[model samples]
Target: MRLSLISSIRRPGFRVRPLLGFWHRWFGLFAALWLALMAITGSAVVYYEELGSWLNPDLRQVEVINPALPPETWLGAAKAEYP
Candidate 1:
């Protein structure tokens, strides 16, 4: 039975050939549209940080910081900032 099914698919002028072609074209068309949307969404996510800074100018400002602070002092500053 399986051999007959396989032979039917490979046979010339069989109904299965056109059915397979129709499915292939349908899937390819939908896949292309899905791929395009994914590509655009991926690009937006990849530049999310830059886009966020561009949209919110306040986040783009820089401040000078003292990097020489000790670990304990940094921990205290972090606690104060969060608390």
Candidate 2:
């Protein structure tokens, strides 16, 4: 028996709507994942210094001197050297 065009065609019941719906669902899932990744990384960038300091408190700490000079005295010394 000879095959007709309609009979020879594969997936006779295939429709555009279902195919598009499948693609849409996957696209939305991937887009949501990418957005979440960007948001997390962006927050990390915004708080880079704080994150580093929190991770290494000893390295970020500064030593304090008891007898620190006043700002006026430092300014006078700087002006004398420059002028």
Winning model by TM-score: 2
Instruction: Give the lowest summed-lDDT range of ten residues in model 2.
Output: 1-10
Writing each residue's lDDT as its tens digit, candidate 2 over 1-83 gives 35676567757677778889999999999999999999999999999999999999999777897779999999999999999
Deviation from truth (RMSD, Å), model 2: 6.0
Q: lDDT value for candidate 1?
A: 0.90
Worst 10 contiguous positions by lDDT, candidate 1 = 8-17
lDDT of 2 at 54: 94
Enumerate clash totals for all models, in the order shown: 0, 0
- Cα lDDT tens digits for candidate 1, 1-83: 99999887775766777789999999999999999999999999999998998899887897769557788998999999999
Error of 1 at 22 (Å): 0.9
For model 2, state the Cα shift of residue 16 in Å. Answer: 0.7
